[model samples]
Target: MNPSEMSFYQPDHDAFRVSVREFVQREISPFYLEWEEQHLVDRTAFAAAGAAGVLGTRVEEAYGGGGTDDYRFRFIVAEELASAGAASYSAGLAVQEDIVIPYVMELGSEEQKRRWLPGLTSGNQLGAIAMTEPGAGSDLQGTRTTAVRDGDEWLISGQKTFITNGIQSDTIVVLARTNPDAGSRGFSLFVVEAGDSGFSRGRKLDKIGLVAQDTAELFFEKVRVGRDRLLGEEGNGLRYLMERLPLERLSIAVAALCSAEAAYGWARDYVFERQAFSQDVGDFQTVRFTLAEIETELEVTRAYVEAATLKLNRGSLTAVDAAKAKWWASELQQRVINRSLQLFGGYGYMLEYPIARAYRDARIQTIYGGTTEIMKEIIGRDIAARAKRR
Candidate 1:
């Protein structure tokens, strides 16, 4: 689809999008199945992306990035990656752009930025954020990992699970409970490097989908961290996560929408080519009408996501708005996938088809980024507050 038909992206944005799409087609798409079999993409892919200036487009120019501060560039990255049926690539990059870079840019001291931003921007150092523990998934109050005060250093002991880019990460921004007695104010963020004496990595996890992406368990056993490692302020991890999570959710929404778009396009092409009953499936009224309805809904959904993207660029996006986008786009993506698969009949169920793998991977979009139920709770509270104001 021409991006011009979509109102969210401008002409310049479309130009950038086309370049990124070409990059994915030429460098990544053909080799993805092999990478999936190995359970990891070749590290060379990251370097190639960095060299192309696609990996960290927003980081300042002095630090080896393109220095375009626009978030739209990041959105283009998400959209193109999704179009290629490479959600793992989209997600792994989100860790670098959406999840990790923000902490260093907004909260890190000058010395910290000077030391890490250049390498991070150049894809020399991969990063991950450690938040969800074995005991706590969404409830920050239940976090049990603790960082204790010891003169100028803090000793941290905790375990974090389901961390993206965890296996190969060179730096991790860890969220630990610094004050056990305080409820929301008790947590703090710390930056821990790979070689921290007591820090160790757990097994790279086997997951249901996104197999090429590294998802692993992490353990910090009496890890000693210097004062400079603290990210924002002491007892402020909750606040930092709150500030960053909307972007993370938005990234998930972008990926889900793009994946659905790709699936729709693939299935549409397949129906026209496959003949049955001496006619193309596309010739059948039922198949034609099914695609029509799906296409309309997808276009409408794209408009909503684009509007949200604009709000995000303007720094006007709210948590409730992001919740609405994340939940609705993901739910719509699943619906589109299901309907498209039905049109494909038996071929859709085959492992060889890309749609089958997309269906499997799309399942986690709702579950991981705060489930649909959680999103409703957030939206419900917003509704209640507005009612009271009235």
Candidate 2:
């Protein structure tokens, strides 16, 4: 079912979806090929998205954002982007809206908000969260990046890899170790600006899919920032990360479900239209059964994701719940896209086909945010703890 048909969405949400759909058609669909070739989307597209009122729907009106705090609007954006086969663009925007904005809004001091929120909400600037290192992917505790206090300033030095929007972001929320002896409490978050001395962007890493999204290595060689640049309290970065991860995982789940739905729609329509042995390809019982399975899986998954989105809006979504949604929906997306591509036979293997690109794009859903294995670990640990308490 389309997001409009979902009972969780109000009429206002439907209206926002219309604007988002139009934005995708006009700004993204036309230039996506050029972006894919260049390995990055033009910065103007983000500005257009900001103008269209789709970039920062949850930020406060005082900050030049939509100011609703409603998660459904963000889901609507994801749905429309998936429908338009704009996965790369969606991933980049998710980092801004889902990860960076929420971190700032929840943890930043008033001055930090005033300084960063306006440009971010207006799409005049981009933001990224630097968490993963060369050695750390899911393990936040393994982070080697360090920040040392220097009188009124802090000197941050580290390397961050696989950072979305790394190249174009005007601001980055960097996670660093502040007290080596403090364990989990040792980590802290620092706001790094683009022109800061000792800060440099490495190569835009090549990936198999989502090519238009710029992922790069970020280096900090004693990048200095005043106490004012520190986000929240010192030694609270890991706690902050854990607190905010539910929204990030939920955003990934939303994109995965929407992409699966779009792929299913494409396959269903193609199977009915394409001719085979004296009949439509969909007339075959095997194809009919495959479509049935795909539809059923999508419908069931949508219900869970819808519930999770509501929980997020109500401020009750848990890490365990988000983990379940993330792993299930992302794995489902890969399966649905793979099966849907099979429906197209030879045509599915070509890049000209959206399903082919989607197939490539879907592969990363299971790996990023948190991997399928990591999600299971989170859920499994919760289950074990609950059993012990019982």
Candidate 3:
């Protein structure tokens, strides 16, 4: 499949691409490496992104957002960040745009939207979703976090681990079981404010890759919130998650595709510049063929993801389709980056190299956003159901 053959983006999207590239270069590129060392993005980075008008797409204009519902802008921003070797920053922003923002936009009430959208679009408030627990990874049904109604307020008590944007986030959308016996249907989503007395954060977690992004453990010890905080109707949380999960998986697929492109770009630039035996390393058959294979594989995968992105924007993408995009693209990213690193030999092992950081970060794409195994399960179940109907 060829990218040119697909009618994925228009001229307007291309123009927005340049704006995002400049914004990332001016604001993010300079500070990202330092953030990697400190284990957190600079607090100011979020505000800077807000001011740039690139952070909020699909958010209404009245609330300081871009107003247009185009997701191509989000895709463009991710591609630019990956090109600039800012995969960690890309991951952080994706959580806000792809994971957290949609919950408020789709499931939130008009009052909820009025209260939160401005800060969120302005980047004054960071957001994160707490779904993963210590015991459960892809299995949301096993969630033990409980939220009980106490008159006007709901008391929430549960711990969430591996939460992205944990430390710096101003608003957190938490998942807790409102009814113990209702199984998956019992869970509910709540917006917990940062200053809530009972909410406390564990230490910023240390991870092998994406060091600049904050991953933390969060505990809610009887946190209380009004009924207004609940995202949709009572007992519809799991249904909402099931409906919205395709977007999350598609977001991961977009990142994986961009990561592979960046890794290939690095390898392409390096081989021509480096010399072995007084000749360009890129001139050798082994090096040339490896790079060629990576390019071809990535181009083919790019077409599938491009189509998926269009489907998502049209509201026609299915969970099974998203799972296919997520798993294949992530696995392809890992393979491409690994090969790119191997080509660099010793230099690739160093953390300073862009490829090294990319290599480290690519490991988690398959595991998170519903593990590759879980993605296969989703698709397999769909296949079984279709066959049964026949």
Candidate 4:
């Protein structure tokens, strides 16, 4: 809502936002609370997004996708969904559209693309990425899942935890160790279908926030992944994960900011209407100043996020830039949401209010999509490497 023209958004972006807003209002807003109770957004919700042409902005049109690779449309979807207090479903959609779809587009072979792209774009079949294991969260090198090559298939056996869309996903892109002692080079990416033998989903995790998102543990017991199922070259999985991480980090940053801003709006409206002592809470000088500070912070973060978004569109976004945005925005969101919830007083603690839900949902932004500590390490290491080169 800041008036600055960041160049990342234009007339087309505005139109797309309107369309997505209408869709969210009609399809998601009415039933999000029920979905949260179930601990999973109904699969029909994604089908609605697909029907509206909002789920496949980056996919090719030949495969039932939006045909344009513009990321702003995708950004609009994330922004609108979060603004509607549909953060849980938004996180799930982010995994599908931003994380999994992009990997397949970049790393999948022609056959892989043809087999997966249509259902993915259409939302008839969901997609999920399996990365974090019980032993490996931020450290990709610690991956212990092994894939041994057999006659025509690679027998994979390991467990992946905290898998997004775990239960509903039809194809899961898994990273497994192909060579036991190759360090980071030992890893390989495999597209494992849900129907494969020994591929089973564990219990859906009972998360503190984002409850409507299907987060679960996945088990692969000698799962058969054919040679053609390999994504790009073997021993190059870590490199692929590294390359695609910037966008995923950026997605988290965007969600954090928009979610925070929405919470602020809810708090502002409540404080103005609710009576405290003798007058509206907004009449207090301290309350007014707090609103001013949060508004300013949101504007400043928006400028940086817009700059990064444009850079991504240009194919010039760097990992360090993304790390900076991810850590700062997520940390800022926590601050802003905590303050906003305080403004609501007793109402904020009640689960019936949007601010309360936003308070809970905002907690996980810093932990997932790479933790704040991990992001700081990435930025710090990049700076040290640059200094050495200079």
Candidate 5:
């Protein structure tokens, strides 16, 4: 690959990716099936990731991080983790770097940053975003969780489910309605520490895929959140979410595309090894042509995604654009997984195969971070609104 085609990654980035890849291969991949069986990744895995500096690449150096603020660094981590077939690990890391750290960096007080950011960077502290309630999924405006203005504290009462890293999180950035009548304008974000009274996690959720990643229900019953805990200004949570979601969506795209790549690579290898009609399956025109088509499609998708990543780092990426990348890449991922699985025939149907696991994991990409239908709605709305203005 040419230098620009490699994006801004230097020799150091390649080296870092190599280290991460090695870690995943050695530490993560070997134990993934067991972790999935147990329904949660080992707590030590977080500590290990923190010790490796994988958890803190995006955090500033002062906070015990790598001091590399390059978004591409985080992208490399995602790509490597996905390639290793560690979707749960990838998702957990994304929560730390993509969703949680930004709140501390952008809105935290000096003391708050010092208190939390360091532990976060070290993976000693896990973080989760508590925006979706039992009543609200994609619609943040429907949030009913209330945070009442108490003297020096806000009493937060709400329930959030399907929370990634819920069981492991030492802290959560919770979205609660601070102004009852103001609608989306009234919402606010708060950082609730794990030991706080009334901050408790319910049952660990059983999911189809990503089993090693902890998903749980959280309850905030009269949770007393101090003024020091508020993330940004009152009535600004929606704006913050909208602003940061592009990065989150991009992270999802990275995972989806990388997973597709892994699945394709595995299927190609399998075809070459399996014999059919006295020849390797890959030697058959049908199998060889299928792999060729997938490679071309994957490269094209990767290029668009890389361009989107560059735009994001430059701060010029838009929501609709991110939506396009997220949906298209995720959909392409589903296609790749399906075709790869088909190439494996009955073998693909078994969970023992990597393609089987990838097939299960790829289903959620279009559903989370906004659905494909929702993405189209957003892009279409922007188009229609611009036409009307013209």
Candidate 6:
């Protein structure tokens, strides 16, 4: 089924997509290459996105946001961004809307919400979540960033790597170890502002893909914040992370599916227009078969992702299910993009083409969010536990 025909999306969602498409054409397409060369998207793009009413669809209207609880609007944003060949910008926006904002809305106090949500929703400020430390990639328990209580303030000291929006974020949600003796119960979340003393961003990392999205190392050396900056309860941070991970993973899955569809469209158009052997490249039997296989894979994956998205909207999506969607869709994205690029022949290898950029960008989808290996481990553990009960 076409994505618009999916039962979960209403006419309003389709209407929202029209504006998002225009926003991408006007704001992103013109300067995306420049941003890629700079290794960062201009900060103004975020504000423009906010102005277009695409940045804060889930935020409450009271806080200058779209105020809809429905997740379909966010999905539309991802779809349009992917379709526009703006995957790096899409990933960065996903981090802001899907990851950081949800944490604040779900866990932040009323005061906290009032203080931060407006700027976030308005695009005056950008947000990032610091979870992956230099020594910790998939293992949240391995986070080495430490937060110690010092009188009325907490002193945070540690380094985080691979942080999205690290260089430009105005607010950051940092994961720190608060009570080392408490094991899994020890970690906590703290809200650190950009200008806070001793909070500095390291050089933007040179990545293989998604280069326009600023990924950098974040350092917190004796950064002090009052008790008010502590998010939720001190020891519940790990639990908070676990509870919110399903949304994050699902967001990645949505982006993956949309990107794969975009790449396939690009290839399908290219093959039909390019001539080889006195006929269109698509006229060849082998090319036709590849396109057929890709279409089948995408439709099948779409059905699964659509189901998961509905479950998420209903607040019933499990960690295992989201893990399954994330791994499958993301890995499928890499496969589809690679295959599509091959259809472009020599032109695909040239950086001037969107497919070439997509070829590079699609590589990271499988690695981040969580590795496919980690997703399988989560699924396997769940199965083992269920069998034990049975």
Off by over 4 Å in 6: none
lDDT of each: 0.86, 0.94, 0.89, 0.90, 0.87, 0.92
Give the per-residue lDDT digits (tens) of candidate 6, residues 1-390.
Answer: 357877768899888888988999999999999998888999999999899999888899988889888888898888888888898899889999998888888899999999998898878899999999889989999989999999989999999999999999999999999999999999999999999999999999999889899999999999999999999999999999999999999999999999999999999999999998899999999999999999999999988998998899899999999999999999999999999999999999998899999999988888888899999999999999999998
Model 1 C-alpha lDDT per residue in residues 1-390, reported as the tens digit of each score: 656566666788888887888889888898888888898877677767787778878788877888876778887887777767787777788888788987887889988888778878878788899988888998877888899999999999989999988998898999999998888999999999999988888999998888888889999999999999998889888998988778888888888888898899989999999999999989999999998999998888888888888888889888998999999999998999989888789989985788888887888899886898998999999999999999
Per-residue C-alpha lDDT of model 4 across residues 6-26, encoded as one tens digit per residue: 466788888887799899999
What local lDDT score does residue 226 receive in model 5, on the 0 to 100 scale?
Answer: 82
Error of 2 at 247 (Å): 0.3
TM-score of each: 0.97, 0.99, 0.97, 0.97, 0.96, 0.98
Q: Which ten residues in a row have the lowest lDDT in candidate 4?
A: 1-10
Pairs that clash in candidate 2: none
How accurate locally is residue 204 in candidate 6, as Cα lDDT from 0 to 100?
90
Kindly list the per-residue Cα lDDT of model 5 for residues 93-142, writing each as its tens digit: 88888889888887898989998999888888898988888889999999
Clashing pairs in 4: none
State which candidate, 4 or 5, has the greater TM-score: 4
Error of 1 at 356 (Å): 1.2
Could you tell me the TM-score of candidate 1? 0.97
Model with the higher TM-score, candidate 3 or 6: 6
Candidates ranked, most accurate by lDDT first: 2, 6, 4, 3, 5, 1
Q: Between candidates 4 and 6, which one is better according to lDDT? A: 6
Q: What is the lDDT of residue 88 in candidate 4?
A: 87
Total backbone clashes of candidate 6, pairs 3 or more residues apart or in separate chains: 0
lDDT digits (tens) for residues 80-172 of candidate 3: 898888877888888988878889988899999988888888788999999999997788889989999999899999999999999999999
**Range of the 10 consecutive residues with the lowest summed lDDT in candidate 2:** 1-10
Question: Against the true structure, whose TM-score is highest?
Answer: 2
